[model samples]
Target: MTDIPNIPFVDLASQQNRIRADIDKAMARVLDHGRYVMGPEVAELEAELSKFCGAKHSIGCSSGTDALAMVLMAKNLRAGQVIFCPSFTFVATAEVVAWLGAKVCFVDVEPDTFNMDPKALKAAIETAKANGEDLAGIIVVDLFGLPADYVSILKIAEENDLWLMSDAAQSFGARYHNAPIGTNGIATATSFFPAKPLGAYGDGGAMFTDDDELAEDLRSILFHGKGTSQYDNVRIGMTGRLDTMQAAVLLEKLKIFDSEIVERQKVADRYTSGLSDIVTCPHVPEGCQSVWAQYTTRLPQGLDRDALQAQLKDKGIPTAVYYAKPLHRQDAYKHNLIAGQTSDGVLPVTDALSLDVLSLPMHPYLSDDTQDYIIEHIRGAISDLS
Candidate 1:
């Protein structure tokens, strides 16, 4: 405890400095244009993002949470309809379903990819059906920048007649089998929550789709259901337009996203090589690539996770828990959640996972010196406990 070094979980300044000039220019233009709500920048960003993600249309919304909510609303998903999701993700993914009064069925995740476990997903759908949960959709979350098993996940949705929505909040730039994410689902939602791989300066998100009808529905629903004018409310809607300033910021950030993705891969690789034996590292399956939003590693057996974090903190390295608890155990939705269980009532897999995950400081800008410092401390911590 002599001198605590300052190491952030994510260093946005490193990226900010690289595009400071463009950012300033974009801000100046937005200010001079004066269309803060649904400005020209909004359309431009939508176009750019759609093209980037290989989608036919992309609609900007208030935040990633709103983006998900808008899609749910536009689809007319009712309260009693059941939706399947992984309990391993940020709450925003499942919260949207509950906000619409839908039943949430918590699915388990793969210990390696940290994405939805397709086997568990199939079983969950069956479980919901057997229990009369009235399944309507399945949201596939791209956890920690790695795309879920979309190939199989989408197949499950097709067989079950459930809408497939890609919750790509953390995996906007990730790919599966050489195909981009947004185009895979009926609607794909991504967040520009400042810390995301392709974040805006503040809260913002976008929905992408090729279904022209759904796209139009989303557009109307996003702006108070205005057919051609704001006062014309055609359908039930919400005030969820993306801010002009945030669009401007994202446009500039998008310029370097491709390169940033390449750098992210290198950083992830370094972490795996440097610390693979010390703990369980994230695994990117064959034909899949992640943007490396968080280089999470599982704690060694019997090692105290809290003590490990304290040790890393003492040495100028930082860490985080992606989620310390599963959604089924959470107070908000515990009443409605259907945990993955066997016919005789067994869920040892999920029971073991809730206590093991830890996210290390990960971003494209992690320097070699910083990486070495972090690795040294992490190794020391793991070694000390033994």
Candidate 2:
């Protein structure tokens, strides 16, 4: 293999170089104001986020996990109620449900889009109902950067009298059916975890909602459940505020976020065009636009994924597995109920996906030459393994 520089999994440096001056100026203003917590920048960012996604309200928080938890807290999620979630996703999605003493029933996902399967969700709700368990809500994750089947999931939620929350942590900049992601579900939560499409310098997240009462509840819950002032606590809450400095950084990143999304789609198009015949490329349904948070591909059946990754590394190509194990298979969530679990007790699609998904280097700055090199090496590695 020819020698080449190691490619970045997500190039933050290049993005910084593009907006360094604006970032510096934004940070300087925050420093001069001396209101590191809930300062002017925080409000400015929240307003901009709401405008970007067409949400009536946007509440900035400390992290993605906190953003989800705060919503659960505001909704008063309690023990014994079950909330359905996809098993093939980050633990944070289910973790917040457990934190509130609620049961998390794991659901399967679509084999192609990798988002929660609506059929599986409906089956889970019926199964829980037959067992006399209380059904509360559903948290549908937009896996990778593509929005889930909200059109189907929302109908199911309405029929079952359950609310819906979208985990848009990875798909914040994406769109679904000509509408922005944050406007689909009852409330949407997104992350700014430095690796996301519209990332901040450090940990940050926000919640978007058109519900006025929910928005007010979230604002109160994020700051010790304050009624009017911080000293006057009315309900149980935590310190979940986003730092002003992180908000300032995010304000700058949000400026170029739309342009970055376009660049990411171009890179994804190149990958699909170059490698679709060799591997199963990601699928984006009509009227949906993925931000391409991670360009994940499914390896061919019987292909040795470990061998392919190792061989790619030998050629200075970096590769990663988004999830080598589904959440239901993890030790922490082994005992959770899996939707559509029969005598075999497995989610067929989620289990299969866990063993095959591989993420390549993805970022707006990924040059065509670098991407072509990565694609060529992937082809070579797969051919050798086959």
Candidate closest to the true structure, highest lDDT: 2
Residue-by-residue lDDT tens digits, candidate 1, 226-340: 8888798889898888999999999999999999999888888888889998999898889998888888888887889899888887787888887887666678876556544
TM-score per candidate: 0.96, 0.97
Ten-residue segment with the worst summed lDDT in candidate 1? 339-348
TM-score of 2: 0.97
What is the lDDT for 318 in model 1? 80
Clash count for each candidate, listed in order shown:
1, 0
RMSD of each: 1.9, 1.5
Error of 1 at 295 (Å): 0.7
Q: Which stretches of candidate 2 lie over 4 Å from their true place?
A: 335-345
